[model samples]
Target chain A: MQIAILSGKGGAGKTLVAVNLVNLINLSTYIDCDVEEPNGKLYFSSEYNKKDINVLVPKINYKKCTHCNKCVDFCRYNALIDFLGKVKLLPSLCHSCGGCKLVCEFDAITEVKEPIGYIYQGDYKYHQIYGGELKIGKESGIEIISQLISKADKEKINIIDCPPGNGCSVMESIEQADYCILVSEPTIFGLENLKLVHELTTLYNKNIGLIINKANDYNNIIEDFAKTKDISIIGYIPFDKELAKLNSNQQLVSDNNKFKPYFIKIIEQIKQEVDL
Target chain B: MIIALPTKESGEKAFVSENLGRANYFYLYDTKTKEGKSFKNNFLNELHGAGVKTAEFLLKYSTDILITPRIGEKALEILLETDINIYKSTEKIARENINDFLNDNLEKLY
Candidate 1:
């Protein structure tokens, strides 16, 4: 079964939950969908095999001779600007929708591939792992993520560490996943953002469970929220200083026995839900 | 006037491109008639998506100046040639402080 770990906001310990879950599961393929800032690879210290991926952008051939404004008018992204009877092509704004190419009577427009980001594949002892990294100053993070997930070895069970926020990246990561684990803190902002993520999951019609990180004084609030939403509280990890210290030293949560039980419990719950 | 604010979030500081290192927002404030508006954009995402070759969505709105914390060489060069005044300031809310700079109520923060 494919499981997607996500949070509506950043720095909400999604990666922490993802890495630990991967280590606890019997065997699973791991994917880091946060192309902008993929820190999941840091947990396993796995050597990644890098591969570049490209996105197609529109290229105009001026030699085709017709200076008709049809191409400009057809572009919804304002990628084509017609000024003084001259057409200017803005490749960046181009979503490569092929509308301009399709509209141009004279075959003046064609698609050209542009480098966007890289996908890194590696192994964490038993699990095959893949993550994506968007080139600095590059857009289309969701595109990179989609490509990376497509390349995931489907033969094995998958765990996707989703990008933060309820934007395009998060949507692409969990698009077709079998289940979703919404990792959140116990604060008010955490609950609010978790609700946003829950709403998104409901929209996708995906089964979801919650993992409350830093479980402390806010347990009652979290439990109440879970009960009202009918979302299962899979597991909770207490605020542990040793876990924080290990993380600061670049150690995985699985390396600490104190945190292993929480991960194991979540893994067991996921297996039961998915009937794995 | 329409001003550009390079922001980490939606609303924040208006940074000047020529000065400062890291600014939350690159705000574009109009000094002519005491009317100020900020254009908040995700600078990292914009730069990543467009690669500084073209100013499509960025230059769509009308603006006289682009106040940013720090703009890369490519974006700065492109915006400078477009006849836009690029100012550098550390002040977060430059619209409120335009009068301060004019009246000497605020010194150049950067």
Candidate 2:
């Protein structure tokens, strides 16, 4: 079964939940779809295998170009701009639809591959993890994530750490997930974002369960919200100083079996829901 | 008066500008005239050094000056040479709040 750990906003313990769940599952393959700020490898201390991923961008040759606005008119992303009879290309905004090159009457535009990010593959003892790091200031996160998912080993149980927020990256990660684990805290912002993620999950028709991290004074509110939404409460990890200290020391929660049991139960619930 | 603000995407409100330290979008506000316009270029894409020419294209819209959170020294020097005032911004943009910015009430937004 493929499970995606997601949150509506950042800093909601999605990474924490994902790492712990991978530890609980033991043999599962992990994919970190949060290319913008991939921290999954940090907790696992996995070896890195970097693979450069590139995207096709439009390249204009001024020498052979007529200053016609054909390419600009063909570009739907507004990546091509024509000003004062000069043609300019914005490679970042270009989705590489290839329409510009196809429409260039003078053959002024060509497509070129530009490196956008790198994917790192490594192992955490018994488990395999693959994560990507987006080149700073790059916007092709969804594309990079799709590439990661395509390379995912479907035979092994998979746990995906999805990017925060309900943007294209999150959507792409959750699209093919067999089950989803939404992690959130008990704070007001957490609750609001939890609901937003829930809405997105519902839109994607993905089975979802909730994990309330740092269950402290806000447990009641989180529980109430879960009950109201008719969502199942899979597990809760209390706010413990020991866990914080261990986290500071870069220790995985699954390092201790006692703490690992919670994620084990969550994993079992996911297995049952997906019939794996 | 036309002013340019760097935005996450074009046609969206400027959340952070190049002068702003780190924000979602940037807005260029013209105080003398009540005109607020956002420059559409994906900042994340620009960060990858992909659309530098596109950014330069948007820079043409700046009639007088620009307001950002924090700009790189290189971009700062380039804008400086163009005779555009680069001021730092500390607030997000909304449709209504932009008019107040043009009327010299930018301090209230922050």
Candidate 3:
């Protein structure tokens, strides 16, 4: 079963939950799909086989051009602009639709592969982990996330750490899940964003449960909201100073006897729901 | 020579729009004939490349000068390549700014 851990807002402990879950499960494959700032790799000590994630972008061959300006008019992205009586192409703005190549009877435009990110595969303890990191300034990483999820070991249990927010990358990561775990903190902002995530998950028609991280005085806010929304509150990790310090030191708190049961309970809940 | 003025409205009362891409309308004034015509900036609502597309649209007028508040790099690049001179608009009023540019009172951007 493929399980995705996601949050509507960043720094809400989605990585904490996902990393802990993988450590506790021991046999599941962990895929970190947060390409923009993937921190899940920090918690694991493993050697990875790296692969570059590439996307096609248009390149102009001025030698083959007739200066007809058809490609400039055909480009919706404004990547091709009429410059100094010649057509100039901006690689960053090009979406690689191949429209310029199609419209150009002179065959001036051709597609070229551009590296957007890299995917890394390695094992952490007994479980395999896959992570993607986008090159700085790259706008999109859905393609990398999609490829990573597709390459998952279907027979083994998979836990995916999805990117934050309701953007395209988050949607792409969570869409392939057999079940979803929505992580949120105990704050008004957290509650509001969690509600948005809940609505999106419902739209996808997936079985979703909530994990309340940093549970403190603000627990009632999330508790009441989850009760009203009919969402199952699976686990709660209280705001503990020791746990935070341990996390900062790259220690797995799930290995501690005190915190192991909470993660184990979550696993039991999953096992009951799934045939794992 | 034609002068391109960024405007919020279509008539003589039109004020200069602060943003070139989001301008509601563009007033094209023919300096030789002393006649002005206004057209809606159709690319105003576009999500991306509005500035570049707006510059491309302005190309049809064969404008010799542009009077506006500010222009970004992408738009400036396109405008410079087309040999259109850019003049910064100090006044909020479109006609007054155009007069300043035509009278060599406003500062040229490039």
Model-by-model DockQ, in order: 0.08, 0.08, 0.32
Specify the highest-TM-score model's number.
Answer: 3
Scored by DockQ, the top model is 3
User: Could you give me the TM-score of model 2 versus the true structure?
Assistant: 0.73
Task: Specify the CAPRI tier of model 1.
Answer: incorrect
- Chain B TM-score list for all models: 0.52, 0.55, 0.94
Question: How do the residues B12-79 of candidate 1 rate in per-residue lDDT, one tens digit apiece?
Answer: 33323333223333444455654545443333333232324223334655555454545555445455
Residue-level lDDT tens digits of model 1 in A152-242: 5666678899988888788989997989999888888888899899999999999998988888987887788999999998988889898
| CA RMSD of all predictions | 7.8, 8.3, 3.7
| Residues A226-275, model 2: lDDT tens digits | 89888898888888888877866667976786677777777777766776
Lowest-sum lDDT 10-residue window in model 3 chain A: A83-92
> Where does candidate 2 stray beyond 4 Å?
A73-78, A82-86, B1-110
Model 3, B7-27: lDDT tens digits are 989975689988898899999
Weakest 10 consecutive residues, lDDT, candidate 1 chain A? A77-86
- Note the Cα lDDT for every prediction shown: 0.71, 0.72, 0.86
Instruction: Sort the candidates on lDDT, descending order.
Output: 3, 2, 1
| lDDT winner | 3
